[model samples]
Target: HEPVPTEWTRTTCPYCGVGCKLEVGVAGDRIVATRPVIDAPSNKGHLCVKGRYAHGYVDAADRITVPKVRHDGRWRSTDWAEAITLAADGLRRVAAEHGPDAIGVLGSSRATNEENYLTQKFARVVIGTNNVDCCARVCHTPSAAALKHMLGTGVATNSFDDIEQAKTLLVVGANPLENHPVVGARIRQQAQRGAHLIVIDPRRTGLARIADVHLAPRPGTNVPLLNSLAHVLFAEDLVDRDFLAARVEGVEGLAAFMAPWTPERATQLSGVPADAIRRAARLYALERPAMALHGLGLTEHLQGTQGVMALIDLALLTGNLGRAGSGINPLRGQNNVQGAAVMGCDPGTLTGSVRLVDACQRFEAAWGVALPHKPGLNAVTMIDAAHAGKLKALYVIGYDIFASLANADVTAMALSKLDLVIVQDMFLNETANSFGHVFLPVVSSFEKDGTFMNSERRIQRVRRAVAPRGDSLSDAEVLCRLAGELGFGDQFRHTCAEAVWDEIRAVWPAVAGISYGRSSRHGLQWPCVDEYDPGTAVLHARRFANADKAKLEQVDYRPTTECTSEQYPFLLTTGRTLHHFNVGTMTGRTRQQLLRPTDTLDMHPYDAGQLDLRDDMPVRVESRHGEVVLPLRVSDAVAPGQLFATFHDPARMLNRLTGPVRDTVTSAPEYKVVAVRVRLA
Candidate 1:
C-alpha cells in the first residue's frame, strides 16, 4: 500500500560523524525538501551544506537499481535470483579450489547496524573462515585498540555536548570544521566562552584559526610531541598526585621511562617549538578540566596506535577521565564505526572487542557455530593474499574498496585475479568494474529501519521514511534471503532487528542495556551491562580496564615509507572536503559538485613557488608507488613542504601514491605521509 500524502518524515543524514537528524519531505516517492529536525539532540536546528544538499546523489543517474553481472567484458542488467545463484556457485567454486581461507568479506561503515551485523555473521558462520573485516580497520581500529588498552572501553568518554563545560580542549590530527561540522561548531562556541583551545596538526586548519596554541608539527611526529608533553607535566609536578596515587598504577614506571623525552629533544624530531609544548601542557594540567579530542589525522598513520596510546597517557596523567568535561574522544568518521567494531567486525576479535581465540568457547555456545579458533587476515593482508593468488573470492558490502585501498593499480589487478567478486552497493562502483560476477543493490538510509551508533557510543533509531525503490531490498532483508538460499535459513531466522540486537546483547555484555525500546526514549551509550543501568558516557572514571591498573607502553616513532629526498621533497597527504564524502558515491551528483568540481592538490605557497607550480595549473605528483596528474591549488592553510589532495575523484586516483606501511600493532596505513615530488605538467 502506497501512502497518499505526507509533509515530512524524520531521518538521519548520510554524511559525516556529526549525524544530524533531518526531515525528508515527501510528496510521492522523491524527497521534495530536506531540513534539520529541530527536536534532535546532535544538531538542534543546524544542517551542514552536505546534509542539506547532498541527498541529490540518491537519485543520481548511475545508481545500480538492479543486480548486474559482467558478460562479454561489460556489465549487463540481470535479475536478483540469477545473480544470487551465480554468486553462490562462484563462492562454492572458489572455496573448493582455494580453501576456506581464500574467501573474505569486506564490511562497510555506511551500512546499517543490522546490515553490518548480518554481513559479519554470514562471514563467520556460513563462510567457515575468520577472514572478515571492515573499513574500520583503516580508520578507527587503532583508536579501538588504544582505548581498550588504556581505558577498558573504546567508546568516547564524554559527549560532544560536554564541550560547553570544558575548561581546556586539546584537538589533535582532525580538522573538525571540514570533516565534522556540527561538532566543530559546538567546540567553537566553547572556545568563544573562554575555554583554552589547543590544536596540533601538520596543516593549519579552521580550528587552528581561533586556537590559543596551534602546534604545527611535522607529519608522522605525533608520538614524540605527545611524549614530550607528558614529560613536561611530570617534570614540573603538574600531574594530579592524588589521582595518580589513588586511581592509576605504573605511574612511577612510566615517569622513569619518559624521563629522556625532554622538550628540547622532542622539538628536534616534531619541529614544534619547545616553548609551545611546555606552555600547552602546563595550561591543560592547571585548567579545571580538559579534554583530548582526535580524528583520523591522528589514527591513519604509521604509528597511529602508538600515537593514540600517547594521548591516553596524557589523559591519565592529568586525571581527565571519568569526568563531565574531560576525556579522550575519537571523533568517528562515519556513523556506527564504533558500534560496528564493538559488534565484532574484526576477524581477530568478537563483539565487545574480545579476542576471538579467547572468547571462542563462549561465542560457540551462544551461536552454535563452532567458530574458528585461529585469527584471520585483516583488509591489507587479504588484498595482498588475493594478489598473490592465495585468496580467490571477495564479497564487498557498501564500501568502495577499489578507491579506499592503497595503490590503485595493484588493487585493480588483485580484483581482476579473483575468481568471484560480489559487490553489494547502491551504485555500480569501480570495484564492480573488474571481473565481478554478481552485484546486489542495497537500500539507502531513507529506505531502511535500523540503528546507528554515533561517535559518543550512543545508538539512535533510524526509522524508514519511504518504500524500497524498484524491488530493491534493505541489506538485512537481502542477507536473510541469501542465508535461506545458502541453506542456513533456520539458524538465521531473525524476525526483526530487535531479535538480533537482543541476541548480541545477551552474548556481549557491553551493549547489555541497549534495546529498541530503550533507544526510542533516548539514545543509549554503551557499557550498559545491567537491566536497570543507564549507559555509561565516560569510562575509566576510577580505574582502568586491567583491574584499575593502566600500564604505559613504550613506543618510538618511525618515518613513513616514502621519505623526502632531493627530487621528491614534498609530503603528500590525502583527506576529505567540506562538501564531499568518501569517493563521492553520495555527494558527487549533488549541487555541491556545481559549487566545486574536479580535484585540487593543495600546497603551501613556498613549496608551490619552489616547484614552479601555480594555482589551477596542472602538475604531476610522483611517488614510489605511482603518479597522478592533478591541478595544484596554492593555499596558506597547508604548511611548507606538505601537499594535500582530496580522495573523492576517481580520475585523480589519489590513492595510487598511497601504499600500506601499517602500524605494528593496529595495522592502519599511514595515509598522512608519503613523499612526492610536484612538477608542472
Candidate 2:
C-alpha cells in the first residue's frame, strides 16, 4: 500500500500536549509514513492513532499554497510582495485612522516558541500595541493564574516520568484515553501494577470505568467535591503537619475556611457520596506519593481559577509537593499552550509572566523603541471593542477564533464589524472563508524549524521534514518580512531558526541556558538557569518558589448564575473527541474522516426516553444564545440530565450554546456547563 522511504526526519508530533517523538518517512517530498521512536522520554515508543495516520492532510489538494487577497468577496492569487504590501498598507490605514490601540493582533498556541516570540514582539515593537493574546485565554489561563497565586511558578510540579513512581494517580476533569492516548496507556499499565487510581468527573469516561474510586460530581460543583476531600484530610488528621510547617503558610485560617464544607453537606450539593469522598481522600493521602492531573473540565467554568486552587489545596495538605511521584499538573489542551504563554503572548505580561512595565527597560533598550505603558485589551475584550466600534483591525494567526470562542453568534458579529482581517494559515479556514481580507499561506510545524514545549515543560525540537510544497513560508519569515515592509526589518532578520532561538535565550533569563545544541536529543526542561546547570525534572524539591513557602487562598463554592428552569432543563458540555483535533481544520482533510465523519450529541437513555426520543433521531438543541440540530445517540457514558458533544465540526457550531459567563479572575469562558433544551427536529 505504500512505498519505501528514501529519508527519515525525527521530530515531535504536532497534535496534543503529549508531544510524542515521531520519525517521519518521506519519499521525494511526499510523506510516506510515521513511526514511534523507542527512547522518547515523553511517549516511550507509543504513538496515538492521530499521530501515526494523520499525515494525509499534509498533502491535501485544497491547501492554500500561495498568497491571495479577497476582492469584492472573491479570491484572487497574488505575489508575496503585493500581498505583504497590501497587508501593511491596510494596517497602516487602520492605525492612522483610529490610533495604535485600536488594532488587535492574536498569537497562536499551535505555533512554535520562536514564532510566538516574534508574534508578540511584532505587535509591541512594530505596531506599538498590547492588544495581543492567544487561544489559551479560552482554556488554561486560569490554571496558570491560580497556580502562580499559590506557588511562585505556574506550571506542572512534576514530570510524566513520575508515573512510574506514583503510588496513586488522582485524575480530575480529564479523559486521557480519548485525548492523550499514549499517556493513557501508561496510566492503565500503572494501574495494572497495583497503583491506586481515583477519577473525579461528571461523565463515565474510559478511565472512570476502571478506576478504584470514581466520584461523579454534578456540573459546576468542583469546589464542593474538592472541598469535601480537603475536609476529610483535616478531619482525620491525615495531613502532613511537618510538610505544612516547613513548606506552606496560611494554615492558621484554613480551619475556619474549611469548617463549613463537611463531607455530608458537600455531598448534598456535589452529588458525590460522603462515604466515597472519605474513601477517596484516605486512599490518596495514605498512598504517600499521588499525582493530581486535571484538564479543561476543571478550568472552563465560572469558578475556573478557584477550582484550580482547590485542587492544589489537596496536594499541599498531604505534603505531595517536591517529590518524584506526587505533584499538581494541568493536562494542557494545546501542544504549545504553556509555551505560548511563556513566550509573552498575553496582553498583560512579557516572557516568564513578567509584567510589561518591569521588563520595559530591558526590551526598550534592546529594540531601540519605547514600549507602550498602557494596558491594552485582551482577546475577549478586543472582540467586544470591535463590536462597539472602538477596534477596527485584526491580525489572526493559526487559530479559528470565530469557531473556537464562546458565544459564536456574538463573535461573528464582532468580527464582521472589523475593518481589516488578515488571516495567516496553511489552508482556507472557517474565519478566512467569511471575513479574511488578506490570506498569508504559511507552512505547518512539520515544514518549519523551531521548538515546541509540551505539557511537562519539556522543550523539544521541531525539525523541517520536507521543504514547502509551493510558495509558502514559515511563520517566522512572514513576521520578519512584514516588519521589513513597516521599516523595522533589520532587527528581526534572523538567518535561521536557531538564530531566532539564540535571541530568545539572550532576552529571557528563564530559558537562557537552553540552547539548540543541548536540547538536540531528548530536549531540556525549563528553569535551566546557566549553561552548566542541568534542567530540572521535578520542581519545588528543596524549597517552594515563593520564598520557600506556599500560601493557601481561602475561597468558597458559589453557584453559576446561568440557572436552568422549565424552558431549558438539561445541561450541555463541550469537548474534543479522539478522532479529531480542535475545529477539524487539518484532520477533516485527512483519512481520519473514515473513522468519525461528523459530530453527534451523546445523551443518556433515560433522558431520551423522557423526551420520547430514540437512537439516531435528529434533535434540535436550543440554548438561550443559539440553536443547532444534531443526531442523537442514546448512551450511558454521560450521567442523566447531562449531554456531551465535540466542537471539532464547525458545521455543527456547538459553541453557539456556550455563553459569555467567564471566570471572574481569568476570562476563560465556562464551556463545561450550559442550560439547554432538546426536542425532535
Candidate 3:
C-alpha cells in the first residue's frame, strides 16, 4: 500500500491571544506537523510550548465522535438528526411552558467569530430571547465596561507591535511570561533594547526578576497603589500639562479625588514602600511613549473596574493615548475572547458595541426578525436565575461552567436544576455530565474554517487542516441545523463559513472590508471599512470615539469582600500556569500533563512553617464555600498570608473554594482574593 499524500494549510494558534500563525502539514486525516510562519505579524516565527505540542489532543482516544442524548441520567449514542430534534423539542417545550426569557444561550471564547455570530443570532431570532453571554463575563467584563466608559472603546488602545518603540513598559497584575509567552518574549526583547520595565504583581514573576522596579503590593489593593502613583505625579509636577489641557477632561475631579491618597498612606495599605512608589511614578510619568498592559489580576476583584479606570487615568494623565508607542492594553486570556465579545455575545450590546435599539433596527432590516429590546442576563446572573427556578433551558457551546465559574458547587446545583441543557463540545465536559440533555460533538480549531480576533483586535483566519473525526461537525453547521429545526430555516441559509462572515460584514461595520481574500496573507485589524483602506493599528489618533477628549474617572480605594478573619486566616488566590489552561480540557489530554501532573497549593515558607506543613505533604484548604485537598508547595512567590492555586485540575476543584463575591458594576466574580483555612491531611 502507498502512503497518503501530504498537504499544507495555514491557520492561527488556538491557545493564547498572541495568535501565532502556523503552517500545518496533514496526512491521511491527521495533523503531522505545525510550524510558525516567519512573516506572521504577532509571533514572527515563534511558537510556545502549548502551541508547538498541544496538537496531539486532536486525535485523542477519548474524543466524542458522535452525538449523545441523556436518558435516565445516562448518555447514549445517537445521530445528529435525533440529537438536534431532541434538543429543539426540549427547548421549545420549556419556552412554551415558561416564557421566552426562560431560555439562555452560553457562547464560547474558544470558538470562532462566525460561529459566535450564528449562535447569538439563533438565540435571538429562533428562541426569541436575549439571555446570551460568554466566559468574558468572568474574565474581562471589567475591562470592557471600564475601557468603554473612559476611552470610548472596550479594546486595546495600541497594537503589540508598538512595544518595541516604547521607552518604558508598565505591566500591572499580569504574569505574561507564563500565560502569554510570545508577548512575554517581545517584552523581554524590548527590555534588552534598553526599554525600562516595571512589573506590578504580588508574585515574583519571571519579568519581575529583571524589572527596573517591581511594585509587589498586597492582593486586592490596586486602587490605592494607582491613586498613590497619581498623587506622586501631581505633587512632583511630572504630569503632562499640555496633553491634559488639550486632550483630557474632568481633571479637577481627579485632582480632588487623588489629593488625599499620599504615597505614605499607600505604602501602609499596600505593603509597597513609599520610596518605590515615588520612583515608579516618576519613571512612568517622565518616560515618554510608555505602554501599559494588564491581565485578569487587575480585573478579577470587587473593585476591578475601578482599578482599570484608575490605570486608564494614569495613561491619560501621562499623555500616553493617540500615539504609536503609548496606550492602555488589556492582555486578553483566551485566543478569541475579544472576538466573541465583539460578535455581540454580550446581552447588553450588539455587534460593534452599538445601542440595543439601533442594532435591533439595523439587524431587523437585514435579518427580518423582531429582536429583543431590553438587556438580558449575563453568565453569573443566568446561573443565579437557574438556581432560583427562573431560567428553564440553557444552550452551552464549548464551555465548562462547573469548573470555570467561581462557585463550582453552586454552579453544579444550578445545572442540575435546569429543565433542559444542550452542550456542544469536543468532549463531555463537567457541566455536560450534570445537565446536558443533548450533546453534539464539534471539531477542533485545526479541523474548522473561521476567524479569531486576538487581543490587539486583529482578525486572523483559521483554515481547515484536516477532516473532522468521525461524525463531528463544525459549530456553524450544528447551529444552522438547529436553527432550521427551530423554524428559522429561511433566515439561516449559510452554506459555508464565508457566507456567515458575509452576513457579519453586513451587520458589523468594524470588519466590513476584511474578507477571506484580504486576510489570505496576514490578518487585518478592525475598523477596516473598505478594501482599499488599510486596517487601523493604533486607535484614537485624532480624537476619541466619544468626544475629542478622554474622560478621567474619579475613583477611590475599596477593600476586598473576603478579608482575613480569625477562622479563615489566609488569603487564597487562583490563577493559570504555563503548561495548562483553563479547566485543562485540551492540554490535559496531551503530554503537557506529564510536566505538571497534579495541582498543588502554593504558600510562603513562613506560612508553611507556622502551620507545620512540609513540602509535598498533602493538605486540605477549606473556605466558607467548600474545600479541596492537594499537595503543598512552599515558595516565596506569594506573601506571608497569601496562598495561590490553579484551576486546571478538575478533580482538585479549585473554584469550589472560591465564593460568589463579584464586582459591583460588571458582576465579575472576585477569584483573586478568598478567605480560607489550611490543615494537614
Ranking by TM-score: 2, 3, 1
- Write candidate 1's Cα lDDT for 1-681 as tens digits: 334437677767777767788888777777767888776777778888888877776677877788888877788888889887888788778877877889998877777676677777788777778898888888978998898877777767788777877999999999888888988888988899899999998888998989999998888889999999999988999998888777777888889878999988889988999999999999889985898899888999888999999998898788888788899999988876666767777888877778886798997787787777788888878888999999999998887888888777788888889888899888877787655678899878888877788888777777777777766777787778777777778658988777777777788787777788887734677778776888876677666666776766666667666678887788888898898887877777787888768778999998878767789999988987899998889999898988899898876778898876777787878788888887888
| Cα lDDT over the full model 1 | 0.82
Question: How many backbone collisions does model 1 have?
Answer: 0
lDDT per residue for candidate 3 within 1-681, as digits (tens), equals 323438879999998888889888778878877788988999899989888778888998899989999999989999999999999999899989998899999889989999999888888899988899999999888998998998889999899899998999999989889899999999988988899899999888889988999998888899999999999888888889999999999888888788899999998899999999999998898877999989998999999999999999999999988899889899999999888888888888887877687678888888998898889999999999999999999999998988899988998999899889999999988888877888999999999999999999899999999999999999999999999998999998999999999889988888899998998778998889989868989999999988899989988788987888999999888999999888998998888999998888999999999999999999999999999998999999888999999889988989999998998888999999889999997
User: Could you tell me which residue pairs clash in candidate 1?
Assistant: none
Ranking by lDDT: 3, 2, 1
Lowest summed-lDDT stretch of 10 residues in model 1?
Answer: 1-10
List ranges where model 2 is wrong by over 4 Å.
Answer: none
- Report, for every candidate in turn, its global Cα lDDT versus the true structure: 0.82, 0.89, 0.90
Clashes of each: 0, 0, 0
**Candidate 2: RMSD over Cα atoms?**
1.1
Give each model a TM-score: 0.97, 0.99, 0.98
lDDT of 3 at 581: 84
